[model samples]
Target: MPVSPKIYHGNSTPSPDAELAALIDAHPKPSSLSEYSYGTAGFRYEASLLPCVFVRMGIFAALRSASLGGEEVGAMITASHNAEPDNGMKLADSHGGMLDAAWEEHAVSLANAPDSQHALALIHTLLSQHTSTGDGGNSSKKKLPKMVVHIGRDTRSHSLPLAALVIRASRAMGATVIDHGEVTTPQLHHFVMHANGHMLPSIIPQRCNESGYCEIMAMSYAALLRTGSVGGKGNVGKQRLHSTSTLVIDGACGIGALKINQFQHIFEKLRAEGCTVGLPTLHTVNFPGDGPLNDKCGAEYVQKQQLPPRLYTPSSKGAVSKRYMTSFDGDADRIVFHFEDEAGKFHLLDGDKIAVLVSSFIQDELRCIDPEGKAVKCGVVQTAYANGSSTLYLKNVVKTNVVIAKTGVKFVHAAAHHHFDVGVYFEANGHGTVLFGPKFYDFISAADAKLRGTSRHNRANIALRRLRVLPALVNQSVGDAMSDMMLVDAILFLRGWDLSTWSKLYSDMPSKQAKVKVADRSIITTNENETAAVAPAALQIALQAAMDDMISQESSGNGPKPRCFVRPSGTEDAVRVYAEANTQKGADTLAYEAMMLIYKLCGGVGAPPQPLITNRL
Candidate 1:
């Protein structure tokens, strides 16, 4: 039985210490299981094992907010591409990014406490650290600032109950919790960042609500469309705006679909008032209840299989005449675009393509704004998983500096923030965002002020206006499918380019990704960039020999040579092998061979993995 809060600290309000003890007693970790460690995202497991974890995390979120002097922190309940039975939670720091690395260890300690006594002790120790200390005085007497936690959830059936646990635990710790129910992951991030004063209301133009997200997106998009391109680049008139077929979005049958529908309604409302230009019609498929989330659709499916979603199969009746389509993951934080060529073959424009295109456009804009390259510096951050062709094009063709970061969005986000004036980062899996440094924003503001003297039709004036509104068009705190789609559309309209034109900019070398189940995935490790395996010397040696053999076999190919790497997956119980080659067959063979090698070398779980069957002509 759970202890009532009123029973502790006397009267109605319980003391923090007493309340914490009661909460810990109410939710205890299983002694039979090993300690849960926070991973690349956060705590994830079967929904059945998470109720206790949520309570502890909720209390920790409150502690984090108090530690930050009452700055708003966020707790989002989502699995993000995982099956419905599996759910997870990730905490956002005051800046609205992933939890700070320094505190991840503390999170582990709190979640792994053996019993209620140990848990209470850990909480007390953490609480003492956050209190003021002076002249050997007792720190426990000092009162901490009021803590605030912003909570959001996805459409998972278990998500609401889990969110309720978080809210209850947070309030028990004497923190105020604001519940934003059924929001996309990025929307919650946007709310926290906006509430904490990181983004200017004048620039973003949103009030931190569902409607606010749409308002800011619509406003920025309209601003960009109204400003004609400089030089001979075409302006976005009515015809150019709708030149392409209706954009069909595969929503992965999750919360993103609902959010897209809401955005569409908002767009239509704004269109009627003439506050926005008419753009291509957005038709969303696989909405909630259309099917189980991410069964055979979503960005992950399209990017890995290199096929259209199940609903948009080549022979399916739902296939549109449009040359382009896009898909959003469960929570709408990631997006990827795909299209069919004249031969009815599918082509995916994964995150690598998005990074190249966006960076290239920004590069051109910066050069146009200042040919001397003095105002801003542009750089792109990619993971080892990035297609080699994309890296080559970015370096040789885009004429920009490219840096490699370890896998995961946090690392890339950090690298982009530290490396350049305008940092563009994206994973090949379609999770990405653009970050504009303070210096870049300052430059744009100064340019806009200087161009005030010229007519709005001046090329420089138009370019400056577009630059000024670009940041608002992006969800700077995180990757947002809605924001990213708008940015891509605006750029395409400005450059007078279409899907085929974008695809022709650069070609992707064929690549394959496969995973092998292992008894213990942690036994495998890799270098900082994750391009090569480091641990289990025998495994590394075997992988190297395999990669060497494949490269030697493809040395005389027409395109890029073969490259391969095997790394342990952060979110699963398997080691993932990725191989790239000049031809699709070579890539597939290398991937299959490597997977089998890992399974044989390491402890094999079930049957050995099998290669996927492709029916493409």
Candidate 2:
């Protein structure tokens, strides 16, 4: 057996043990809640269990920071897409990106520590394991690195106390801590990315909010400056919005709602500061402080159900299908945009759609930016969750390179970095962003500077300007619904198109997702790409037969364009099945077939899977 290294702060002040002890004691006689395994997000469970997790995470954050030469590690205290009572915490790397995959086990280890004392000991072990004294051996003299941690949270009522626990725990460890109160997940990420470089965030309250808006807005405004309706030159007399141009926002009554309100205030301030383009008039709904968050209204609900949230019922008045509408998840990390048709049909533009459209636009810009045909190639990365038609369209139609990765942002982000001028990644759930490699940004900067003296009147010049500003406008730190909304808006406005026009880009096959309780989800392993299963070897064989059957059933050009796959969920104790077909009936039949087969093989906790059919939107 190996020996444990000495435990002490390397170069910081002494630990605040009294505070740590009191905090550990104050959280209440720790209820012996069910065990929790760190999932795609870090530690998540009911808010009650999160205090203990937060305690361990505080130390984990400090260790992470110290290991990175005292760089500030980011911690966010919001459970995105989960119900209101659920809360989770995840660490950001030194520069405001997702937590490194290699280091995740250490966190999960710390989370699994049986009690405070065990977690405390694990912290020291983590420090020793990660510390390098610029020497070759792990012999002796290793010590804790200096630590700095930054914390932020959403508007969850339960999150505040959890946030406080993180604060106290970090303080107890003698790490430098900064509390940026009540920010969306993206805002926290942006702050981390900005603070890591010369892009320091404003320390002031109102100014911080205003400055944050300006950073993304500055880029967006420049891009849209040529539009007269946006206060530029052409169509100068056109109102900011007509009937369809007006936006109705469903915030999911979460942090996104509050930020939308805050952004509206910042827009006014920006207008006062000589910004020309007007912020679109927004009708905010489902804002936080109004009701339970993510209860029944959010991107998750809209996308999965293929319908608008209950609160978002179409009015009898305006053009129901024409107006643009969007929804954000509980913590504002995911978004799905939709609109109803004149015939009261609903259309969803999910992450797959966003990836295709956004990447295509960027690809077009790259061609024009280097019009000499030097070929600044861009590409897309997606998960198995991406629609099959989307993957095909991207590979064949868009002509951009396409790569598939596992089901998390870190994996996709890494894959996108390997070979592309720009990489766009998104889950079907609407969590994703466009990444511009350093060389790409440098190329854009050079192109913009080269065109500095040219007239901005030409549409080509305007497009180039938008490309230049896009690097800044994109929240490359993470997938931000707000930033993405702005990007989609800019693209639609630039193209002079509406949802109807965008919908015409490609039609989504009718798809369905189902969840089945499983006795041992762990046994349901996935293939490397997570597109198919690895265990119960016969499962794959069965799925193929089901596809063949579905295809045979629809052989005459009306059959299901059958696609089906099943995998165990990382966060929940269930297996998820996905199916898509050219027709609603086909999709339903495919989903039902897949579900029934999985339940038969995988110890499902219900009556045999029943056929679930809904009118496809």
Candidate 3:
């Protein structure tokens, strides 16, 4: 008989306390125990199997603490927004970012070492030598080492247990652990800096007088406030501002609700001071009674929801009720927002919107601050899946340099570190990360110092200046919904512009993506050659010929040629089809037509079936 599945709430599956105790005692041996193989995010593993991974991670944390002047290390084990089947682990640095590539390579090597005994010995030696002498290899100052590691998880069923495993391991390693419980990825990152003995600056704006000049002054004051200072502080003198922001948060019924609640609290406090805060009213549909809220109801499933009433018209007057709706996956790391027009139509604001908002805000505000200033030129780094419109807008409209990297957060993180000041990369499925340049940090610090020196009356003016610059500072160096929300809010609020107006600023080209799940996981792509396995080279040539024929039939040869990238899905047993064109109809037509041609090449199996075509922005 097929066993019924169990369910749990508040970031974990329902494992009976007795069952959990039994499972802990059984110690179901993992396929293998390895060292912390930290990646872009950190050490990740299947949650059910994470206890084993945590054992390895504990040793690694001890090693990292010893080597880095006795600083504590941490682990993150939620899959961000991946499906339930997938889970991962990541090792966070003392600074809250993931370990650098060199360190990650070292960790991976340790994990893949031939002998576990040898790996443990190496870890032990590293820890002993570093911790014993307070010498981080070359440092001579006896650093009053205060190492704090903040750990949290999103709403994945495995998150709680996985987080518990991490907490247990960190404590076992003798590191003081602050269990943030369920929090957004960005909030976790923010806590890292905020809790690390750093006093962030806050902005306080004076009430807007009838002269509209007060509003301008208030806006400027808000702008001047340092990004990190606003939320951590208890109060910002009363101008009584309600967020005036209405967000339809598709919480995915995951741990995102925790983060969303934090945002609500922030807005609520602002509302108490007098700001109009609106929340995305949730209306559940197609939810299963027995199953946990882990399905497509949140951001991933938002494309399928009924268009909210506020988005119906583009030109409807009286504040058109600008609404920003976002959904996070099973874990709250990934985010995708929806903007409604006056016509009650929904539009997706994916990584492209992120790029657009970040780029436009930086360009407009920085120019206002100093027209001829040669501050570091901000750039947007994205994956190939970025919408054609985004690339064009960043280049022509925003005039920011853009770099296209491969998919995955690691690649984005690496590119952000290497190339740009503000790297914005998001997968078509809505995973994203942002990188902020060091110079941006310095600028905000200087502005904050100026504010600190001013008197109370001038404090509001200082706050205004900081507010103008807050968008650049508060945003996380990683892709996070909370950070993205704050970024979007800062941009639109400062400009008093609505989302539809901003989205219309640039025309987006049409793009379509298709997923094909294969029955056999062994049918993997080797060396990027899609036709390597087919017996006859002629068959490969034939497939290419078909794609070429389609491309040749294009009507307008003006823009870039039709682009398609076929690859195996990273997280699923399937193949993915991505096609982009100048027009949506054209993109869809070409995609479907190409699928047919490819299907014919594959012995007419019809390219492995898939679920409905999810219209992800």
**TM-score, each model?**
0.92, 0.88, 0.70
Off by over 4 Å in 1: 1-12, 30-32, 133-142, 198-202, 229-237, 241-245, 275-278, 312-322, 556-559, 608-617
**C-alpha lDDT of all candidate models, in order:** 0.80, 0.72, 0.51
lDDT tens digits by residue: candidate 3, 1-617 = 11111111111224222322333343434555433445446655556656655555544554565566645345555666455665776666655566656666656655554444445445444544645544442122332233445666665666777776655544444455666665556545544533432223232222111122113222332333223233323223222223334555555656665444544444344446754322222222212122345454555555323233222212331233335556665555566666656665677666677677766766655554445636555777777777767777778878878877766676766777688655566665566655566665565566556557555344343343543445333434345665455556555554445566566776566677775555443343423223122433343454455446556776546555666555555554555666776666656665665555344443333344433342432
Give the alpha carbon lDDT tens digit for every residue of 362-421 in model 2.
877666557553546588998877887888788788887888898887788788877676
Q: After superposition, how far is residue 358 of candidate 3 from its true place, in Å?
A: 2.0
Those runs of model 2 whose alpha carbons end farther than 4 Å from true positions after fitting are: 1-34, 132-145, 198-210, 213-215, 225-244, 269-278, 312-322, 372-374, 449-452, 458-460, 556-560
The TM-score of predicted model 3 comes to 0.70
lDDT of 1 by residue, 92-170 (tens): 8878788889888888888888766777677667776764423222224455567888898989999999998888888
| lDDT value, candidate 2, whole model | 0.72
Better structure of 2 and 3 per TM-score: 2
Q: Which sections of candidate 3 miss by over 4 Å?
A: 1-46, 84-86, 109-119, 125-148, 194-245, 274-291, 303-323, 340-344, 422-434, 441-473, 515-548, 568-575, 583-617
Q: Which candidate has the top score in TM-score?
A: 1
Worst 10 residues of 1 by lDDT: 1-10
Q: How many times do residue backbones clash in model 3?
A: 50
Which 10-residue span in candidate 3 carries the lowest summed lDDT? 1-10
Checking candidate 2 for backbone clashes, the offending pairs are 321-340, 554-559
